[model samples]
Target chain A: MMAADEQQLILRVKEGDHEAYRVLVGRHMKHAYNIAYGFLIDHDDAEDIAQESFVRIYESIQSFRGEASFNTWLYRIVTNLSLNKLRQRKNTNHRITNLPHQSAMNIISPPDDTSYQDVKPIIERALHALPTLQRAVVILRHLNGLSTKQVSEILRCSEGTIKTHLHRGMKKMKTQLTEIKDEVI
Target chain B: MSAHKQIQSQFYDYIQGGLKSDEHSIIDTHLASCTMCRCKLEELKRFIESPVFSPELPSDKLPPEYWNNFALEVEQKIRTYEIEKREYSLSLWDWLNSLFIFHKRQIIAVSSALTIVCMAITGWLLYVPTLVDEKIALPEISSSQFMEIDQKVGEYLHKSKTLLVGISNLDLEEKSPIDVTAEKKASRNLVQEARYLKNQPLDIRSARLIGDLERIQIELATIKDDAAIPRIEMLREGIHRGNLLFKIRMAESMYEMPRLMNVNNIYSGDRK
Candidate 1:
């Protein structure tokens, strides 16, 4: 939701207007989905996280003082849920083979013609390869055009920490994509 | 750091234009002269600027209906969530008000029975011990042998009380078998002595007390090194149940105070 619109909707919801809450959810749901998509690469998982984030926003709206913009607050919930899902996936300790993301390749198949345009699927493979936080930092900064300070607020970290993560992430992306010739061939 | 590494470090900041002009100029100068660093920066830049980087749309598409019904779905979810939460946590007044609304007779039956049972338990505990106390008075000692026997029994009871109190006071934090070895030995021995005392010819109070103390001694003897806290709690519950601890203390003092007065009376008669 936009900052001013969300604040008014929030005041109405707090005053027990359920319709105002529905308006807020409808307005912000797509941005929530995109934010979730940035962190979690799957479209369905992105929708699930976004929906769950809205549910959380509804449940915990009483504690929302609107000190931070609702836009930032919504993004924070989506990011935290994605990170938690990542941690749970890690704890299961499934062995990760050097296999590529099937979802990434199915959509972005390179043509047989030798062009640097072949780098699309390879970039997809590279993007999904980084750790959860690094992937999130890269996506939020590069795709969404969030500043280091903005990314820091959403991820709940210092600006310096966000920069460190963003750099390490971009550097990893550089390493993996540059080596695409060896992997894709 | 080498010029190459230094330029590499600032490359992201340089691309974002976050660097101060002086720092930006130095990196820009290095990049102009350096082939490898410049190539790395270009590659990184292209990857960040790609369709892969800006996937606000998913690579795979979702249904139009999914977006359309999302708010209504979320609102329905919130409504269901509220209903479920209300069912889980009802305020006392709310639950009672609802109970009266739906099932007044059943509520009255349950509350009335609960009150009666609570009162019965309280009255029994209070009244039974006082009646038992009254019925078990000591015999009048008329001879020196009787007095001597009374004195021996008194000493044994005093020793048993001291041991039981000490065992009760033992901290459960002491975990080693050796830490409780003395208490265990004394308690085991007290069980046998108390059993003999229960069987001896005595007033009803003495017999009842010996029985309680024997049970208590057995309770104490069974406490394993590590299970002291729980077993001590069990012992305390039993002691409290029948006012057993209070009776034992009263019997010990009842025997003691008169005996001290008699000694003084005999001494006065001798001086006369």
Candidate 2:
């Protein structure tokens, strides 16, 4: 049902129908919100950035070119804007400090369910310690399920560079998890 | 390769999808055969699939009013652009009015005055050419006289060649004929000079001459028998031909130097 609605919405929006724009905003809001949240890690900031991204998309509709799927382009814009905002916040020295080291055990696991609840916060703390660009690469590669080529296009970098970042990021995360495991033992 | 290094390299390639089908099959077979590698691959696959963090869904949902505020901001910016466009159009109209509407009489007066001045300048230009044609004259010279002058220049060049050959023979007689170091140095210099001359544009006649001279120099430098006087004489003839070619190319370069200098000046000016 959502796929059919999305196709219809895209056709209508391409024809310059304002009503179609509204439908698109409604349909994609959750996905856009999730991407923004992934980077900013703050609900309010994510919502604001997602809304602004939609507005910019509407104004620049003529510039879409349609070389990539609409969802890919929209997500790329939201991710870039969220990362830029994060960079600005870091520069202003207004970043949040002294947050507790969230463990990964709290995340819901698909297979073991029981182990997930204890590991989620640990995973989150380990992710936060990763360098920002590497963290972004990992999230886009794994969580978003984007191929290396797609991630490279969205990140405006070579596919090789993206692979290197992913490799290093995963290695670092593995090391961090091992350290956490030692502590637990 | 050692087993550990081979496994590490294969694991890296497998993860990257860079291995060929044959190599991939080899790795797969090894994994199936080896329990340790199979376990490592499984652990890596599970770790990558695991989530980094889990966040609670947002609770303070934005009311529909927020979107309305965003739409209003966009509308205001668009309206401002429209107003600026109108002001720009008005300024352009005022400038056109000053140039054409208010100054129509001045424009007509200037046009008639310019036409009379142009007619007077055209008459003077037409009359001056015939006057100069009648007064100026050019001298006549015969083609045979020009040819004689060219032959004299050739004779002078031939005399210079003979003088150069005499000087070279005297130098060779004075020096130790079998000194390997001197012969090597001379050959090296000849090679360097030949290479430099090759880079320059040479006529067919001159190029063949230089080629012959280079062959002579090479042979003379390599001579192991002092008794080879006939071979040395033949090499001398080759050297003379080569020297003649070099002289011809040098003369042509001298003629082109001024034009080359002008091009250099223009290039330097562009850099500045």
Candidate 3:
């Protein structure tokens, strides 16, 4: 939530208010975890990055000079930390295994929702297959529901570039999901 | 039809609500008439509207207890981090305290005498320097003055590049931190030089490059002897993000090319 209320929490946080810090962490932790999850499909890695991101922000909160909104700053940190994790994974030649399909389907509260169950892994794999920038644009733009302008700010690129990446990323996912559509039709 | 091509391009913008009303109507009309376009739009919508892109995390995926304790866990982590930092600083003091316990009186007497001698010398030195320093006037910087500054900046950039490359090429498996001591020392000197050049009258381009250089140089200079891999990786990321080495090389070439041309012209004149 890009509410002005965070400004007060941030000010209190800066003044060493532990209650304010707790409030701030509670408010943004899910968003941070979700963004990290968007980059890293693994829940454990996402949780780790999300927790570490908040810790980094707490340590360097003095440097957070309200230049951009707090959410934007948090998003940038989550995004960078997630990318670093991915890079580390790559350097170590580690592979993240996908959850078993039946178990993944079981996690959905309404197991009767067959469409989402069928397409969830497919969509996730397509997203994972994207180039880093395109995947980031799609995740921030679509998954996080940030505006293109916000995505551009977070990615530090022009809006045109964001649009191009978004367009390309969606097209790829759409192609991958075409089988589901044909089955439905 | 060319209309179909144009309409396809707007599908993303249409779904995003980013198109103007007129543009939106054009796509709507095209989709209504063309079954192919309608199906394509439907396909995009299906993918875009999938629960995978939802902002809300699927509740069942994570236990409720996890959310309940997330904030507390973050706070606990932060507390642990602060304690570790405090202990790191406290260790330095503890070392000094132990030394003082062993040689308390001798240390006190020596420190007291040294302070008195230092204060006396400081008083004499401050008194003498004011008179000698007051007569010196700041001179206007000529082009050649900045040219010299540019040369020094170029040298600084070269050295910085070498140090960064050295850091980059270091064996990641090396457990020892002392290997970076030389690089850190060189960065410290570059930081001093950067500060000096920053105060000088230089062109905007030179000034900006130096500003970026100063940031990374400070990071490099302050790298702890016990720095972890992540710390060094962060420094490398900063260099990559700013494209610092590339910019430095471009800046050096911009400054060097002119001087090289001038030297060439002088040699040609002498030959003539």
| Top TM-score hit | 3
DockQ of each: 0.26, 0.15, 0.19
lDDT by residue for model 3 (B1-272), tens: 26665577567778889778998888888888899988878877876676754444543366567878888889899999999999989998998999899999999999999999999999999998886666434556677887787777777666666667766776777665545666666677778988998887767987898888788778877877676466778888888888877887888787673343222221122321
Indicate whether candidate 1 or candidate 3 has the larger DockQ: 1
Tell me the docking grade of candidate 2: incorrect
lDDT (Cα) of model 3: 0.77
- Supply candidate 1's per-residue lDDT for B233: 69
- Candidate 2 lDDT over residue span A1-185, tens digit each: 13566667777777877678776776667667766765665656776788778877776777666677677778889988998998898899955453322222122123445444366445655666789878887667755556676777778888767766776777687888788668767
lDDT of 1 by residue, A95-134 (tens): 2343333463344433442333344446656777888788
Which pairs clash in the backbone of model 3?
none
Per-candidate TM-score against the hidden true structure: 0.51, 0.47, 0.56
Which docking class does model 1 fall in?
acceptable
Off by over 4 Å in 1: A92-121, B1-10, B16-40, B50-56, B90-272
Candidate 2: list runs displaced more than 4 Å.
Answer: A1-15, A100-121, A157-164, A178-185, B1-27, B33-36, B46-272
List per-prediction Cα lDDT, in the order shown: 0.71, 0.60, 0.77
Give the 10-residue window scoring lowest on summed lDDT in candidate 1 chain A: A108-117
